[model samples]
Target: MRYLPLSPTEREDMLTRMGLAEIDDLFADAADKLLKAPLDLPRHKSELEVERALGALAAKNLAAGAVPFFLGAGAYKHHVPASVDHLIQRSEFLTSYTPYQPEISQGTLQVLFEFQTQVARLTGMDVANASMYDGSTAAAEAVLMAHRVTRRRNALLSGGLHPHYAETARTLSEMANDDIRILPPDPLAQEDLIAQLDDSLSCVVVQSPDVYGHLRDLRPLADACRAKGVLLVAVVTEILSLGLIESPGAQGADIVVAEGQSIGNGLNFGGPYLGLFATREKYVRQMPGRLCGQTLDSQGRRGFVLTLSTREQHIRREKATSNICTNSGLCALAFSIHLSLLGEKGLRELALVNHANAVALAEAIETIPGVKLLNQSFFNEFCVELPGPAAEFVERAAARNLLAGVPASRLSPRAGLDNLLLVASSELNTDADRATLVAALREEAAR
Candidate 1:
C-alpha cells in the first residue's frame, strides 16, 4: 500500500478519465514485443530475499578490477585516482543541480567554466561548451550543428568511426530528412575519405584512434572538407590520446568532440560519462549545449555565467541552436578536478605510460602463435586478429580469470570480423596483467 498509493477503484477512475480501457492501453504505440513482454519477476519478496536474489544476479557479471582487464572500444578501463572519487562524492558537487541562478550558483558555474576551458585547450579549439550527455550524443549534436551551419542535407562518415556514434548521428540525420553516407568499417586506415567529399556534404565525421584503434591523419581530410566547404567534425573516444597525438583542431577540424571518461571517470559498467564539445570561435554561436563564460560582477568581483544564449530553454524553440537543456555537471566537475590535479605535463606523462603498456602488450601477444597486430599507429588501444573466433577466445580467456578484449563481431556483427578482437592497455595494466593476457591467449590458441 505504501508503494501503490491509489486503490483499484481510483486507478479505474483515472484510466476512465483518460479515455483508456486499461493501463496497458497507454502503451499502444510501443511495439508488441515490448508492450506485451513480461519481466518474470516475483510479485513480492522479503527485503533480505530480494537483496540475496539481486546479489546472485550481480555476481554473474565479470568485475573489471577483479580480473586482468583488456576490454576497450569506446569505454576504457583507466585508473581513477582515489581523490577523484572522494571529492566527487562530496555533497556540494553530488547534490548540485543545474545552475539556474548565476549569483547563488557561483561554485557550480565556475566549475563548468573551468571544464569548458580545459576541453578547449585539450581539443585545441577556440571555445567549448559546459558539457554534453556523452560522446555519442555530442556527435549527433555536432551533425545537427553542421547541417544548420552549412545549410546542407548530406553527411559523410568515416568507416572507422565508432558504430554507436555513427548510428546516433544517422538516427538524428534521418529524422531531419538528411542523408548519412557511412563508409564500411576500416580495420586498416587505408580509406581515401577525401575522395568522398563533395559540395553537397554538410559535414564529415571521422574518429582518431578509431574503434579498431588505428590513428587517422585528419589534415588531409580536413583539407578536402575545406575545399568542399564541409565541416570537419572530429570524434575522439579517448580524451587522453590528445596528450600524445596532435589536437584534431590543429589538423583543420572545424569542430572537435570527445568522450571525457578516460581521465577522471571509470567504466562504471558504461556511463554516466561526460562529453567534451568544442569548436572554432567563429562557429561558437552554432555550437550545441551550454557554454560557461568568465565575467566580472557589478562589484568588479570575478564571476561565471552561461555565455551563449542558444539552448531551447533560453530562446524560442524554433530558433534554438540545440535542445540540450542540461549538462553532465557532476561528471564535468570530476573531469576538471582530475585535470587540474594532472596539469599539462602530468597528462602527457600519463599518456606516455599508457602507450608504453599497450606497446608491451602488443609485443607480448605478437609472439603468440595465432594472434596478429593490426594497428601501426595507436595510442593505448589496438586491434588483433586471433587465430580462432575472437568471441570464443574472449570466453576462454574469461574462464582463465582474464577479462579479455571485446570481439569486433560483438560490436559490428555485419562487419564479418569474427576473428578481430579490440585490446586496450592503460596505466592500470601491469606486467602481471599483460602476462596473464598473453598466457590466456596462448592457451586458447593451443586448444
Candidate 2:
C-alpha cells in the first residue's frame, strides 16, 4: 500500500478548519474545468515491461555529450573538472540547508562564505552574498535593491539586456507595482542613457556582452548615471567574459549582477544556475540574501558566521529585507570548486579559448550565402539574419539531426525579428559543429 503521512480523518479535519469541504475546493475553478474524463495515458505495464519501455524512450534523447551543441544565451556549455562534481555529490553538503543554525552547518556556511568571496573577486566588488536562484532572478532582485538604495521607484532598463532577464524584471516589478521603463533593444544602442536620467529614476540597468553577445563600453554609461545621481546596474550573463575583458566594477557600475553558471556551474537544462550579486562595501547591509563573514571564536579560531539577519522570513514576519530562503548550496559549491580549480590564470586562459572558438565559428559562418552576421562586435553569441524565418530554418536544421540556434521570434513573437537567429559557441564546440550549422543554413537558404 502507498504510504501517506496524513491520515484521511486528519486531512478532513484540517480542511474543516480551513472551512473547505474537500481538497478539490482548493482548486475549485480548476475542478470546474476538470477533464470530464481520465487522461488518455498509455496502459500500465509490469515492472520489467516498464523498465524496457523507459530504456527505449531514453535512447531517443540527443544529449549534449552526443551532439555538438551551439546553444547558449544565458546558460553555457563549458569544460567542468571531474573533481568539481565529485566533491559536490558528497553526502555532507547535499544534506545541509540554510546555514542560519551555524553550529550544525559550519561546513556548509564556510563553503558559502568562500563562494561569496569568489564572486566578489570575480566581479571586482567589495562584497557578495551566498547566492541567488540564478542569473535571471538575481538580475530581478538587483532592480528592487536599486530602487531601495535610490529611494526611487522608477527604473530604466536598456533594450540590450537579455530578453528573459528583462522580461523577468518587468514581471517582478509589476508584482511590486514598481514603475519600469524598458528601452528598445539596440544591438548598437550606444546612446548615453544618463542624459535621460533624472531624480525620478531609481537606476539604469545595462548588460555588457548583452543578449546579442556584444561587449558594451560601460564606463561612459556609468559616468552618465553618476552625474544624475542615478545608480548604474551592470548585468553580465557571460561571467567568463570578465576574465577576458574589463570588470564592470572597474567602470562605474554601482551594483554588478551576473549569472555565475558560465564559470563553474553547468547549464543543467536552464537551471539550477548561480546568481552573482555584488556591490560597494557601503551597501552591504542593504544587499539581499544572507551574507557570510569571517569571525573568530572565543579561542580566536577563524570561523564564518551569518553577518546580517534583517532579512524577512529570518526574523519575525514583519521584519526582513527579503523573503528569499535557502541558497543554491550545491550549485554555488560547484561554482566555487571550479573557480578554485581554475584560479585567475586558468580562468583567463579558458576565456581566451571560448572567445577564440566563437571567433572561429563566426568567421566560418559568415562565408555561407543568404546568411548575414548582424553584430559587428560580440563575444560567444551573435545574431545571424537568415534568408528565411529563423524558426523554420532551425526546425529544418534539427530535422537533419542538427540543433540550430534559437529563433528571435521565440523571445518576442513576430518581433518582425522572424529572420533573426541567435547562436552561441563555447570551447566545447568543435570545428565540425560549425560546419554542420553552416551547411544546414545553406540548405535552408536553398529551399
Candidate 3:
C-alpha cells in the first residue's frame, strides 16, 4: 500500500501555522528556479509497460563495445578481470555493512586495512584511507584538509585539472567561504603552477596526465609549494598511470587523490566508482574518510579495526574532520582483489600495453590530414586538434559506428576549444579500433 505521512488538511494546517499560504510559498527563495510544469515523463504505467518503455530507452544507447570506443576524460573503459567480479560477489564480501564492531566486522576491517595498504603503496604515500566517494569528492576533501592543516583560506587549481574536479573543490570552498582560484584551461599543459603559488594559498592542486592527457612533472611544483609553505594536492583521474610514471607522493605531493575507477572497476555509465586518497604519515590526523589499522588481540592474534573515522556521524559535528559518512567499501575490495591478482609486474606490463596502444593510435591520428597531435608526452590518452569543430567530428564518427573521444568544448564550452578532441586508448582498444578511428578522422577531415 502507498504510505502518506500527512493528509492535505494536516499539511495545510502546518503551512498556515508557519504563516505560509501554500506549499509553494515555502520555496519562495527559489521561486525563480522552480519548474512551471511537471516533467514530460509518463505519469504512470503498468509494470510491464514501464519495463518495455525502459527497455526501449536503454536500446537507444550504443554499447561501448559495439563501436570503436575511445572516450575518456575522467572515467575510463579498461578490462576488469572476470575473477574480480566473481570474488566481489561472494556472500560474505557482498553483504557486509559498515564495520561498527571490529570483533564482528573483522572481515570488512581487514579488507579496508589491506585496501589502505595497497593505495599507500600504489601512490607511494606513507598512508591512505579506506576510500572516498569518488576522485572529485576526494579532491574537494583534500582542499578542505589542506585548509585545516595550513590554516589558510586559499587554494590554487591548475588549468590541467579536470573541470568536474575543479568545480567540486570550488563548490565546497564556497560553502566554507574559502577562496579557490581556477586557472584557465591548459590543453597544452603550459600553465606554470609554481608561478601561481603564494603564501595565502593553502594548496595547489595539479593533475598528472591531466584532463588534457598531457603528463606533468609534479616535483618542481612540489618543491615550489614547499618553499612557499603550501601543500601540494595532486589529482590523478587515471590511476593506472602511476604504474609507469612517478607517483605523486614520491614527487613530494603532500596529498594524492585519484579516481580508482580504471582499476578493477567498469565505467558503469559514470559511477559507483572508487576514490583513492593518500597522504604523508605526519598529516594522518587531518585526512578525511575511514582509516583502517592492524592490531593484535589479547592472545596476540593479528586483527584489523577502524583506526580513524572523522566524519560527523562518528564524532561531534564541530570536531569531525569531514562530513563524508562512509567509504566505497565494495569498490575498494574489488580494487584490492584486482591489484592482488595483478602483482606489481602485471600492473606495469598492463600500463606498458596501454601506452603502446596510445602511441600507435597517436601515430595513426597524426597521419590524417589537418589533424594535429597535441601532446609531446602522454600515457594512454592525448588530445588532437581537428580540422573542424571536434563536436562535429565526433557526431560524424558516431554516424559511422565509431565512438570518438570527448571534445574539449563539451567539458568547457566557452573555452574556445571546440577544435580539440580528447582521445583515450586502453588495453581494451585494438589495432582494428585504431584503424577505425584513423579512417573516421581521415574521412571527416577530408570533408
- Return the candidate ranking by lDDT, descending: 3, 1, 2
Off by over 4 Å in 1: 1-57
Quote each prediction's TM-score.
Answer: 0.88, 0.87, 0.88
After superposing candidate 2 on the true structure, give the runs of residues whose Cα lies further than 4 Å from its correct spot: 1-60, 190-192
In angstroms, the error of model 3 at 377 is: 0.5
Q: Judging by TM-score, tell me the better candidate of 2 and 3.
A: 3
Clashing pairs in 3: none
Q: lDDT tens string, model 1, 389-444?
A: 99988887788788899999988888899999999999989899999888888877
Model 3 C-alpha RMSD to native = 6.8
* C-alpha positional error of residue 376 in candidate 2 after TM-score superposition, expressed in Å: 2.1
Residue-wise C-alpha lDDT for candidate 3, range 246-350, written one tens digit per residue? 888999999999999999998888889899999999999889988888999889999988875644456847789887788898999999988988889989999
Model 3 lDDT at residue 234: 95
* Cα TM-score of candidate 1: 0.88
Worst 10 residues of 1 by lDDT: 29-38
Model 3: residues with Cα > 4 Å off, grouped in runs: 1-54, 310-312
Screening candidate 2 with a backbone cut-off below 3 angstroms (N, C-alpha, C), the clashing residue pairs are: 311-320, 312-320, 312-321
Tens digits of per-residue lDDT for model 2, 256-360: 999888866776678788888899998887788778888888788888888777664657355666678767778889989999999999989988888888889
Query: What is the lDDT for 368 in model 2?
Result: 84
The positional error of residue 146 in candidate 2, measured at the CA in angstroms, is 0.9
